[model samples]
Target: MKIAYTVAPGRGDTDLLLFGLSRCLLEKDVRATGVVQINAARDDAGPCDMDVKVLPDGPVIRISQSLGREARGCRLDPTALERAVGLVETRLAASVDCLIVNKFGKHEAEGRGFRTAIAEALSADIPVLVGLNRLNAEAFHKFSGGLATELPPNIEDLACWMTSVTAAKSSTA
Candidate 1:
């Protein structure tokens, strides 16, 4: 099971990193599946709107809600996020070289989000990569049974890891 995760210091840095990494993998003709978040800034200067695009090709779905400007809690739209997860699950059922989840976030930590899909990919021997943070680190570690490789949070490192894993898969097959 080739499972790896990374954490970026800046907000949205990991999201952008995965997005670029997926695109690069596609350019190299790898079948990278799953979702990467794209954040759009709000005109009102409130929190950015979050959308997840199903990888390879996409049906972008908004996973963030517009809570009142004064509100200060999570703006995640659970239904929308589940919708994105459904889309990713469909893609995962097909042959994929890798699965790139934007984050192993609150939902996943609670065993609700892409947790199942991630496990399924590993079971099928497809490489899995995800963005994770300190908040969810312990939960994710437990979920992975301490097998998840921690990659440095940078494009070069990520790309190299992907290349190595994909090449390893290729040779094994």
Candidate 2:
């Protein structure tokens, strides 16, 4: 039941998205933690009743790791970057149950930091639920093309997605 929500720089309201998704799960009596990018500001002290684990220095590590991975097979030293990525993944796994990709907004795919993290999350087998914004629907359609379905706008959509996926996984298990 773990998930990871990733986002590109200057993307959506990751904290709010995480809070809203966690809130929806709470209403359904499902316990879930919202993992937001480390260092993002949030006013989650309101009505939502769910756990929030903010990665304290996610952005810095994301950059360092991305550079490291990119440098691999090149003349540059990649050891530091490898350690950075490993640290991020380790910390992410230690804190949250799953990862939510919170940055599927307009022009998000252009970010190297975000893209690299998504790759790492996938390699780690962390389930990624991409949250989209209205401003980027057209762009998303163009990018996702035939693979994308029209998702209802809002964090509640996560409930439906999670339920169906969990059911399928359970059936297979």
Candidate 3:
């Protein structure tokens, strides 16, 4: 299943969640891929250089609008949010089977919220799994219609989950 693993700011560990899900799906032979952040200003390094294809978080229009709002000391206009949402939607179209929106990656410009992107994702025919901190796994499962799975806290948990997915799929098949 194509699952969009998103998180809120200080919500949870996105890196771990993405890595875990990727490993799980791969072990299950589910043809998994990912879209993550790439630091445009820095040399290619870290996960960006990993097997997963990385993309820039914000494009020129969003950046320009954001900068304009900051300079004017005004709140982010709906136009900016719409443009930002459009950027994400466009990337998601031909990008991955699902979107793992890094909602917590950065703060929103005033009047902007991660919901903009989430709403767009919801409109698509993909499953979205939001990661949250403090909330128990059960809550997540409930929110995601039991499609949600707990994120691993360490390498061991990650490996186990991957193995489980693989085994489950194998048995069912």
Candidate 4:
């Protein structure tokens, strides 16, 4: 089953949650792959964006940068984003136990970002865990056909779900 951690904006430590969960699952010998956002330091200059890192200790690649302009927004590098997604796709092709994507944000709501990678994982019958906020919850539901479970942003809950799904898969195997 596809699962998503429903986190409120700025309320939950999503990066830490994803990192910890990935580490826990890896310790269990489950082959998992995905991307997580790592925040870089911000100074008086402005807000530094985030780096997209592959799960299970892959290289960290900067994908967004604050573009100081009339309309201030982070400039996302499509090439870098695609490369990160490609890494996930490569891992999925090798048949992993689970896939954990960072978030279903603007790009995803617009049918971009890791949308394709998520679909590929689901099509491979791999359980997916993603971070989603209220703004995009509806879109996520519509995209997943209600197959995604909204999980609390807690390690215990996530670990439990992972155990259950992996166990079920193991039994069937």
Candidate 5:
């Protein structure tokens, strides 16, 4: 049950940190699977489009929809998000050493997204790494049942953690 998460202080920093960490782990030949975000800036000064790159050479999916700039509600394309989730879920059964989910967000908070995937990874004895935000902190705590460890936002520390965790998993395997 090696579950870990990080809440970066800067806006969109968590996404960036997780993306880099995931790529680093994969380059190290760690069998990692999950989704990491890639936000594209908009020319109209609107919110950046959110896209997620599935782990282990999986496809990139756009998870955000551009609602009018004034729209206050969620711009998340649930279907697209689920597509990414489905892809990640499909890869979970393979020889995965770790799972790196970019966000434990509203969907997960409502138990409609990566929550089950995270649980499945734990059940399969695979280590899990997730990015979290403050808005969902309470829900994540409740969902994790106080078992998830908080990781530092720095890439070096995160890579170090991933390296150690993957090495341990490899040894045990």
Candidate 6:
């Protein structure tokens, strides 16, 4: 079954939560793959853009670039995002226990972004954990056909869900 966690809109901690949860799972030896967004460091005191880093210290790809001195107008690189999705697909084919996608945002809602990758993982019967917000909750519901579970931004809750799902999968195996 597919599962997702929804963070409230404007709550800027989704990325951090994903990263932390992935780290926790890694410590327990769960095989997972996906990209997580990290804040870019500025040298000359300018606006910082976001970078997508493959989990567990893989390559970092710049997904957004600062449009101007203001940090408000960052532009997402479509090519970079596509490349990231491709990488995730490759990982999914390698038989991971779970997939941790960064978010099911605008592109996913419109059948873009990592939508195909998400579907591929589900088809492989791999549990997926993705970030979602109120804005895209309806779209996600429609896309997931009500099979997705909305999880709060709590590590314990996420861990518990993961444990249950993985346990069930193992039993069936």
The global C-alpha lDDT for each of the candidates, from Candidate 1 onward, is: 0.92, 0.44, 0.41, 0.79, 0.90, 0.78
Against the hidden reference, what TM-scores do the models get? Answer: 0.97, 0.44, 0.37, 0.89, 0.96, 0.89
* Local accuracy of candidate 2 as per-residue lDDT tens digits, 1-173: 23323232344455466556755655665433223423332264322222223233243322112233224432212353344444545655553334444445333444432345544554554444655655655554454443444444456666677656545544665
lDDT of candidate 4 vs native? 0.79
Give a tens-digit lDDT track for model 4, residues 35-148. 888877667546656797897679888987566644365478778888898888887888578888888877887898889888887776678888887788888888888877
lDDT of 5 by residue, 61-122 (tens): 99999899898889999999999889889999888888999989999999988999999999
- RMSD per candidate (Å) reads 0.8, 10.5, 8.6, 2.0, 1.0, 2.0
- Candidate 1: tens digits of C-alpha lDDT, residues 1-173: 79999999998999999999988888889898899999999999988999998998998999999988999999999999898888888888887889999999999999998999899899888999999989999999999999999999888899899989989999999
**Which scores greater on TM-score, model 2 or model 3?**
2
lDDT agreement of model 2 with the native? 0.44
- Model 1 residue 130 lDDT? 91
Assess the local accuracy of residue 119 in candidate 2 as a C-alpha lDDT between 0 and 100: 48
Tens digits of per-residue lDDT, candidate 6, 39-151, equal 76678677556787776556888888667665564388778888888888887778577878788888889899889888887887778888887778889889898989888
Poorest 10 consecutive residues by lDDT, candidate 1: 87-96
Error of 2 at 48 (Å): 20
Candidate 3 residue-wise lDDT, 1-173, digit = tens: 42323442432345455555555555554432223322232153211211122233233332222333125443334465455556565665663334444332222222244444544554554333344444343443443455555544454554454455445544665
lDDT of 6: 0.78
Using lDDT as the measure, name the better of candidate 3 and candidate 4. Answer: 4
Residue 149, candidate 6: C-alpha displacement in angstroms: 0.7
User: What TM value does model 4 have?
Assistant: 0.89
Model 1 misses residue 118 by how many Å? 0.3
